[model samples]
Target: MNRALPWIIALLISLTANGVMTGIVLHRVAGSPHVSDVVRHEHRHPPRDPSDAARTGGFNVRAFLRSLPEEQQQIARQRFASERVGFRELMLAAQNAQQDAEAALRADPYDPQAAAEALGELRARRFEIEAAMEAIVLELVADLPPEERMNALAAGRRRPGGFGRRGDRRPSPRDRF
Candidate 1:
């Protein structure tokens, strides 16, 4: 019983430590300002310029291209054309990996090993695609005039998918004002 007694005491100590940490985290979370309060605070002080949204986060290449003047657009298009084929190929591979992962997960025998391998491949493919996308965005941003770069990057702050709030087209900076 001596050996078991030491183990039981260790378990009790671990549990107590975990409980204290959890309570501390919960208390901090409860004391934090609510999301609505933060939103209200922000709304009280609007951006000086609507284009400020682009400087903050999210990058939609299509929207960025459309915002450029015709001459700049032509330059950007030439740069993008060379990369688009590889980007599309990467995207297709990622999609196929996703399908394979899904199929592995749904297999009749339910092989955990196979599912894990498929998921790993899907993750790697996704990482490749994301890297390719970041490369394209960075190159484009570098090529853009300083004044327009932020707007290009900030295209998707309020929503996901980078296109817009509802997966539709994103409104240009002009459309906001």
Candidate 2:
């Protein structure tokens, strides 16, 4: 009986360990209630690319425009030719304007009036660049076929989430309330 007792105890311990592992696997696979919280936390403060802010601030508008469809590119070329306002030229002008503002600010950082004027000029140039890019995008998007436009919209809508699908989930803590 004493020998059998040791075997029985060992079997019970092994069974308990297996049960715990199985429960964890099942919890993860079954979409535990806390999965959404985990997902939200993981995405709450997503890492920002350093260039993203600058790109958004109109620095990359010309490159973005250049990457559009061939027809759109041609249209932009024609428009630029007519108006003598090429995207690259506009980008360079914006860059020069921003550099000038920065230089002015650096030269007289203590002067509030000069700083304000420089800042205002920088803002205006950024706005102008953004507006030009937006106009170009609108014109190009308008020229796309209806089906392609719908598909592009759909693609943009589905681009945000990193999860495999709506039904995907993650494991939760055992004491989840």
Candidate 3:
């Protein structure tokens, strides 16, 4: 019995260390938010401004349109209607590609190639959408007076993480213009 005493103690110590590490890892995994929860939350509480102009990254065209006189707004709408339809179609395609990429990433077998291709397509779609938005913004701003054009351009140039680390708190001083 004396010969086995040290071996048994070593085994017990190893098991205890492993159990502690496993528990820590499991606790962290359980505490983190699930992907679906985030998506659901976003869907449940959509952004206040539903316009595509607000959603796109640059040149707050919608705000500029809002600032215009009623007659000008109608002219702007007419100028934008055809382009808007194309932009909407592109956005829909990008959204679908995003879904496909997510599915590929989460598949049981997890085919990396499939995920890569889906992500590539998603990226291309995003580029196309961004280019379209830029073109639209440029076209809209071309006819604007200098002061209004500057205001429209300035509205889109915001700090990336306006909310900082904590969403509930206000943005940091650096984020404010």
Candidate of highest lDDT: 1
Question: How do the residues 59-78 of candidate 1 rate in per-residue lDDT, one tens digit apiece?
Answer: 45555666666766676677
Model 1 lDDT at residue 138:
72
The 0-to-1 C-alpha lDDT of every candidate, in the order given, reads 0.71, 0.62, 0.70
Off by over 4 Å in 2: 1-46, 49-89, 153-177
Better candidate by lDDT, 2 or 3: 3
Clashes of 1: 1
Task: Give the poorly placed runs of model 1, Cα more than 4 Å off.
Answer: 1-58, 156-177
lDDT for each residue of candidate 3 in 1-177, tens digit (9 for 90 to 100): 699999999999999999999988996888975555467554465533534444545444444555555555566677677677797899999999999999999999889999999999999999998888777667766777888767655545432334446553553453212
Position 54, candidate 1: lDDT? 51
Model 3 misplaced regions, further than 4 Å:
1-60, 68-72, 158-177
What local lDDT score does residue 130 receive in model 1, on the 0 to 100 scale? 72
lDDT of 2 at 161: 27
Cα lDDT for residue 107, candidate 1: 100
RMSD of each: 16.0, 13.3, 13.6
Which residue pairs of candidate 3 clash? none
Candidate 2 lDDT by residue in tens digits, 1-177? 587999999999999999999999999899887655556556366444544543333233344443456667677667655645565676787788788777777884377687788778778877776687667557767878877656544443332323446674332353121
Q: Worst 10-residue stretch by lDDT in candidate 1?
A: 155-164
